[model samples]
Target: MDTLTHTQFTEAGLADWRDLAQGIHARFATGDFATGLRFVTAVGQAAEEAGHHPDVTLTYPHVDIMLVSHDAGGLTPRDLDLAGQISDIARDSGVSAAVEALVEVELSLDTADGQTIGPFWAALLTGSTDSFADGQVRDSGGRVPLLWFQDTDAHETPRQRFHLDVWVPTELAEQRIAAGVAAGGTVVDDSAAPSFVVLADAEGNRACVCTTDR
Candidate 1:
């Protein structure tokens, strides 16, 4: 590939905000050239199946590899999932190297309006009136950064950027969507497991609630 310039980097930045994620990298070495070629072939098969092609370079008995799921935008559960599988493949081939690559993403969105809006979610999730301090509520799980609710003057031509994908073993998609609707969120779409219902807050900002099991 050609060298990327600063201008090119700036112009090619992510429009969806998910492109800032990091990928995975693995290094492999073998005593013989044939073993290296075999390793490359095995990696190719895995990449094709996962739909994630890894970067690879080989010189006789040494190969360097890097992996990132560019389609997912940022490092996500999926990226790590693929990384682990790749590690297992390397181990099976008698090639050993530290898997030194992982994607880390940090985000902070402070919307003046979101602060006021958070009370609604706090109430919905907790099943009680919001007792948020200064209109801020927090939800935490794993390495996920804080999802904030800020307070803004006005939103023009509202649209949903982030949504939730709630999973349940059974197809309770409609019922769950109703619960959100009952809690003051508008159900924007319920068309199509791997399905989602787009939603909007009382102020018309968008989010989605979906379940893969459905």
Candidate 2:
């Protein structure tokens, strides 16, 4: 399936946002045939122990799971915490991918103490005053944001947290690296072992330009 990343959460894949209020999903690909069935049963046992039964689908090659709080609209903490435990169980089973892609996270902020700074941020960003976990207000949309507030220690300049991971077809790595630097992102370093390149986004979050050969 074509995957979508909602700031690391794809509704179609594995997830971390699980609660009595929201559903979660997880997917696993096995490296060998025999391991697949065993992994499923192990997952089942784990799920039952936590009093949460995940919706499961499996083929000879891959396993996919969707979990949700049938009661809530999106996701909840219970789902994510259990997902972490399940991942640990599968690691020893030798699954093909370490874990499925994506985690859905919600960032929270408190602007009361720093009203001026907070209002400025609100003007600059899409944040709203809607309340959420732990007395923090959140962005109105279900956006995964790395939030910040007025703090004495915060860098005066906006930090670079945005980065990119680019995967080019094998032989063209260096060419693409040059093009990336020319365009905007800086090529930080090269790891030939995994055939990956780390590039910083305009904002400074590091991303990879990897060929996925490993």
Who wins the TM-score comparison?
2
- Candidate 1 lDDT over 22-136, as tens digits, reads 2334456665788888888887888788877766776686676655544554344444445566666777998776222212222323354665556765565454334444453
Q: What would the per-residue lDDT of candidate 2 be over residues 168-210, giving only the tens digit for each residue?
A: 4334466766777888988677756345777765866665555
Instruction: Assess the local accuracy of residue 23 in candidate 1 as a C-alpha lDDT between 0 and 100.
Output: 36
The C-alpha stretches of model 1 lying farther than 4 A from their native spots are 1-22, 98-214
User: What's the lDDT for all of these models?
Assistant: 0.51, 0.53
True-structure lDDT of candidate 2: 0.53
Each model's TM-score?
A: 0.35, 0.37
